[model samples]
Target: MVRTCFYDRISEKRIAAEALARQKLQEALDAPPAVIEPEPVAVVSLQPARNELTVAGLHLVMPQGFNFRDIDTTLEKHGHPVTFCAKRRPAPDELTLQRSVELYVENLRKNYPDVTIVRQSDRLLAGSPAIALDYIFTAGQERRHGRATSALINAVDGDERQWFSISTIINPAHAELADWLIEFDAMLDAIAAN
Candidate 1:
């Protein structure tokens, strides 16, 4: 009888312990989840300070983000960026700005598929006659817009050559296209002979 009572007591204690564990588990499940906050990101200015650079015998005031790559002789800015390149190339003395632009557009149409000319007009760059051509074309899956400006620089002492500068703003199909174009035009306006 004593053994039976002892066994009964142990079984009761075991049942109580299991009931206590189940009650604790239920309480835990009924509690609300803890909230987590995300980390903050740093904000950067869209228009940074400007920097003056001399490239291909032209003085240019470009934004801080533009980088000059010597391999291709191009100044490029990444992340919704603008690409500017100026080079002196040998050409016939009779090559006018108009003719150079016509040949450029012809080559562009042949190379790029679905070329759409936006505007082509005569403009003055650094007191010299220049031609500006704006166009849009498909590059891979993305549509790109670019402006090409060309001028024939006649040297007083040396052989005459053509001064060609092309500025292209990539991914201009978004909301920031107008702002990018404005910046590009300002950069072009600031160009002068070195």
Candidate 2:
């Protein structure tokens, strides 16, 4: 689109210069949004689980069905946001799986009240972490014997807003878990533009 700016300076040259400036401004405004490419973030793995789930120097030895509510509650009390993982029994088919993951997402939405859920298929692809924003919580479930895992990494921003990756899951296992952590950190770093 073309735009024009007029100056009442009786000089034709001044009016012409202002008009050219306006034209350039209009061109810039008409341009599309800049495509932002995420730069790689250096990710370090959590020390081996040894006898428990360890990350960020915290060693948690919790049983199956154990929700890390204590850790989350404490973080909330202290004014820091916390994100933690929760697991559920797998559904036998895609429709059921979708419902199951959606229920889980809704639970996260209701309970945490301050975190965001990033859902993906429970399947652990050959690649470390497959990042996609899809409704299907876990992919390749039938191929993987119905086993799936989720992870939540919580942190606070400078403004003290409770941010969430609360309902996100990574496939369980030492290597895949580690890789997921690394990639997740990269994803978060990219999101943060850090």
Candidate 3:
């Protein structure tokens, strides 16, 4: 599955510079002695919303008290190969998802010789974070899963892809936790493996 997300501060720096440059340009264009005041920088913070657990309709449904770090640990403990290494999603027009997928596959092969990589799809679901994560999970699983072992490539944005590999490497006694985790592991494996 392919998905896209944006950083809250993506445009902050660029916008500030642009505003200052515009102010200077206007000062030069205007009659002498025109006062040019810089505009205050706008600050945008990305506080995970209360509903952040569910993005774009995909419910992360992490266990109670679960968080990204906790999930990361769980996957690692289960022998699911994953890495939370990507920085941020890129703009659509910046680069194609195919390019990102290719890079991901190449890098994963170079860095992790023991694993396999597969591009799940070129398609992407453009929506909120929840939706994107959900698509990432489903698409990764559908295209890659084979005999309980598979690596998936899903687009996180036009320029970035999430990688992971899924397996029955886990053995948990708690049915509720295990069932939920197998699904989550698939998602993580898809992103982490790459």
TM-score of 1: 0.56
Alpha carbon deviation, residue 10, candidate 1 (Å) = 99
- Tens digits of per-residue lDDT, candidate 1, 68-146, equal 3222333444445455655455558777777788888888889995999999888755546778888998888988888
lDDT of 1 at 48: 16
The model with the greater lDDT, 2 or 3, is 2
Give the C-alpha lDDT of model 3.
0.36
Local lDDT at 43 for model 3 = 24
Report the CA-based lDDT of candidate 1 relative to the real structure: 0.65
Put down candidate 2 lDDT per residue, 86-193, tens digits, no spaces: 222322323333454465557645644543444465432221232233322323541110112332221222222111222334334324343444544454434321
Best by lDDT: 1
Which numbered prediction scores highest in TM-score against the true structure?
Answer: 1
In candidate 2 the C-alpha lDDT for residue 194 amounts to: 18
The 10-residue segment of model 1 with minimum total lDDT is 41-50
Ten-residue region with minimum lDDT total, candidate 3: 127-136
Q: How many residue pairs clash in all the candidates, one count each?
A: 0, 9, 18
TM-score of each: 0.56, 0.29, 0.27
